[model samples]
Target: MDEQRPAHILVVDDDREIRELVGDYLERNGFRVSHAGDGRQMNAVLATRAPVDLIVLDLMLPGEDGLSIFRRLRAESRSPVPVLMLTARSDDVDRIIGLELGADDYLAKPFVPRELVARIRAVLRRVRMLPPSALAESAVRTIRFGDWRLDLLQRNLIDRGGVVTPLGGAEYGLLRLFLDHPQHIFSRDQLLAQLARREFEIEDRSIDLRVSRLRRRLGDHARDPRYIRTVRNEGYVFAQPVSYEA
Candidate 1:
């Protein structure tokens, strides 16, 4: 029997020393690592090389910044390759923006290499264990709530008028969980445990941010949310009735 191949990761950063350090560390941990200096190089490598399981993208790049690259990747790529963002310690705005833009996770600069590895593993595990509906090839499974339709196979949100809205990995995961368990109130800790597979210091605010983004995509007002409603002193609940079709 052929041995299973190690997961391949692409590290995209303009910082040469940091890239090499991360690449070597990941390689030492039994992952196949590739390096790219900038967005251009990153795109080139992705186009010609074998499929990458995850991407470690730095927020700061020489020419095209990481956010722009991430947006373009989400818009263009058919594959939902998970992305882990690297940002400076002070880049709070960038970090939130990265999450809103669909990054699976992120680490601030000056982080432990081991932590990065753990995050990578967690993301891969979550992706691998996605719902069977998401993995089905012959048929598309979708959950309809309100006027929105979530295509599990395509990982996109469509409206009554058939407008497609792309969702980030975290956003999609959270939304999927909510749709699967509509009208159920999920506490912050429960949500973190359910959605984020890896052990990380995820703040309650992070979950709030993701929910906020999802609400925006669903066009649900926070104050008078028709879909997701916040329970006082508790957690959020998906108030709308949900129906699934395969």
Candidate 2:
């Protein structure tokens, strides 16, 4: 998030009342807010307006659902902005899918506007959390492991086929931490201390969820993993041997 100016936020929801309420609340809290009723309007705002720092996307829409929009955004956008999914449904599956697909955070409906504001700040903080010196291993420029290459300068992952994959803020941070100390097991608390934004946390499940997402980007299966392996009650470890390149 840009500290010099009010962060720009795009609120994408079909309900006019909800959109107005959210946009007004965000503006009141010192944000530059824009409204979008659906995927089409959302795209238009993105294409025409100034760059948005974060997006407040609703999961349930009239034509194209929020998940589809999010997926396309990740695949198409060169610099994917942080996304916070707003869903009326209580199903864990929707939440998991959103997280795995690189959403910054998620909130359920009937939420207090205050809580939403807090989450939005937390997600933005995570995005700007890592400094250039955060990763000691990053001085090497590139880190290679398994069948993938991590361009530290670009802050992206690339497959052997040369396809690039974007990593969310937390995902990039967690992966860098693991690469910095491969074969070293880090308990959940240790990992949390390294990555926590010092903001309000929903639960410890947040750490687990982020680790799972990183593993997915590394093409590591949760059950039969190759790169990041579960250490049972101990926590997790980046088992692969990482090599550095200048």
Candidate 3:
């Protein structure tokens, strides 16, 4: 262990058995585990100095569901840590919903500890692999595309009239990739690799959905698109040239 791998995983679940077991398992596997019983506990723990690197959030919490907590954190307009949803629901629709809600990974109940550890490692690796240029800097840069202005430092989307739009974790990553490499047609696989930094999770169509959300925020008409253009056979392209002010 490097003793400074730079990761703080927050595990939230209502079941004490699951929480303790999962926390212990993750700890033994070289993770700094912080456990919470509910959304309130999660918030309280997050209020302390140690910034959470990722979240292992259960869906059916006692008072506030995982979605609500995720939303509350997202509403603060900051880039949320990547979430790994732990759910009992095995439905495809449920999985899709979680993915849409910005969960970086999903693990159904009765999952092996190894699988969970693997997912955690993948997400943590993504965190570590972020280029130093993206978020850490003195002066933040702004990139304008149609009706949207992306503030890299603040991790926000401002409309043409200057109303700020909050970005989900995965959405923020995808936008960062596009802004970093504009006009290049990247296939879904390439986009996922670039965005997740090799943290493999979710179906490939999730890329389409994330891009769709960005397009909606930009008010870019799908029928007559201006920003991200979809290629029939190849992939998608960020149609606008990006400018960054350091």
TM-score of each: 0.58, 0.57, 0.54
Candidate 1 local lDDT, residue 11: 98
RMSD of each: 11.5, 12.5, 11.6
RMSD to native, candidate 1: 11.5
The sequence of per-residue lDDT tens digits that candidate 3 reaches over residues 129-212 is 444443444554776656678887678999878899878777777776666545555667667655555253436777888888
C-alpha positional error of residue 133 in candidate 2 after TM-score superposition, expressed in Å: 13
Model 1: per-residue Cα lDDT over 20-129, one tens digit each: 99999999999999999999999898897488889999989989999999999999976667899999988867876776566777788999999999888866765654
- Candidate numbers sorted by TM-score from highest down: 1, 2, 3
> lDDT of each model, Cα atoms only?
0.80, 0.79, 0.74
If candidate 3 were superposed on the true structure by all CA atoms, what would the RMSD be? 11.6
How much is the lDDT of residue 30 in candidate 2?
97
Off by over 4 Å in 1: 1-3, 131-246
Identify the candidate with maximal lDDT. Answer: 1
Candidate order, lDDT descending: 1, 2, 3
Give the Cα error of residue 187 in candidate 1, in Å. 14
Cα deviation at 19, candidate 1, in Å, is 0.8
Which residue pairs collide in model 3, if any? Answer: none
